[model samples]
Target: MKTPNMITKSLLLSAALATSAVLCANAQIKLNSKTVGAATKAVKAVTLSNEDVIEYTKEYIQWMDEHNPVAPADDEFAIRLKNLTANLQNYDGLNLNYKVYLVKDVNAFACADGSVRVCAGLMQAMSDNEVLGVIGHEIGHVKNTDSRDAFKSALMTSALKDGVSSQGGTAAALSDSQLGELGEQVANMSFSRKQESIADDYGYKFLKDNNINPWYMSMAFQRLLDLSGGASEGGFTKKLMSSHPDTQKRVDEMAKKATKDGFEKPTS
Candidate 1:
């Protein structure tokens, strides 16, 4: 009953509506695709395998070694660390490698891959026995699988943040920027009080097993306590205080354990 012009107008309106519907549907499909992709990534992040962790950690450590000034083989710090850890090359079931970073930051860390890094500042601050105690503590973290867990957590966070690709069941190589972010996360990582205690116990036993005086454990904590008192808010000393918590109590506990085991504190 309508005129030709009216029919033509109706047809145009229908076409416009149909086009709009198609566009909206396409937009919705794109949004849903994105949501699915993000969800898949999240799942991958959560279900990261141990192999993935080691792979990512290898990349991160390589990045760190490239960025930091590692002590040369002939350097005093390197020589000292090599001498100290010579016998520790094959501790327990883990094959360990030691390196000293020629940095002034008083820090030491061990990775899941049995890579132990000691900072020069820490070496200068403590006696040989005390340094061994600190190294023992780091090794304890590795022995307890805490280092692995920490690296795993860091990898998960980095994967979620950086959208690390995992195509064909293989994790993608991390970009340098992503490696930097991951290194930062690791540098600021903190172990729980329980984990600290466990590592402390392991360090204690590690010293005794190596025929070293366990009194050095208390001495190491005492040195850290002394350093914490003079350290700035952002210094590694203060960070260690915050992460380890109960400094005096831990020192006292180590001292008590050492005394109970009949190990006399050496007077230097």
Candidate 2:
């Protein structure tokens, strides 16, 4: 027979061992998720996440497909977009896709379902490095699942906001304003300071991990900052800021990080 204190100690020990085992298992799962991330439980769970948020994201995508629509597949720029995406190397198993449009708006963006669209203007704005940076940023959106999370938040926001209210009751009732908004926002949304920072981090990690120069992202930010004129008010200069963080801030952050990371020789 065991004394009461011994029994209590034994129970405590067993509980601690069990807790450690569980922690170890969870850590392993997290590490595995980080490595192949494309098909991990969380990855697969993206579709199965039964929360209101995930549901809204899926519903919104379906709504947009049938509604606002995209440029046709036969556009000549579409052909170039295809060429660029096809040659995309160093990124794998991310499940993102790409498209191009002839829109004269001068923009680019990525959606949750692996859909990325580049404007003809954006295509002309970049060389190999800047293009990779923009593409990497888009890929960051996919990797972080920001698209889904944002769509969910935007859906809830739209339902409560004037944007949806003024569209008429029927539009709100049958169609997904959240989804429609997601479609437009994904292409044209500007991230908050925090979101922009996270994307910058992701962009750096992606380029660094892939052995590409992390400075390229900083370089692209500089170009956007210079061309966009960075929030001095008015015209095409503010276009990027309308849907993203101030290019100036992003460039500064990237430059600082790159220097710290030993940007000994930037790409020419």
**Any residue pairs clashing in model 2, and if so which?**
60-179, 97-114, 189-243, 190-243, 190-244
CA lDDT, every model vs. true structure: 0.64, 0.46
What candidate 1 gets wrong by more than 4 Å, as runs, is 1-36, 159-162, 230-235
Q: What range of 10 consecutive residues in model 1 has the weakest lDDT sum?
A: 12-21
Clash number for model 2? 5
lDDT of 2 by residue, 44-74 (tens): 3333332434333333333333332244678
Every model's TM-score: 0.82, 0.59
Scored against the true structure, residue 75 in model 2 reaches a CA lDDT of: 73
CA shift of 240, model 1, Å? 3.7
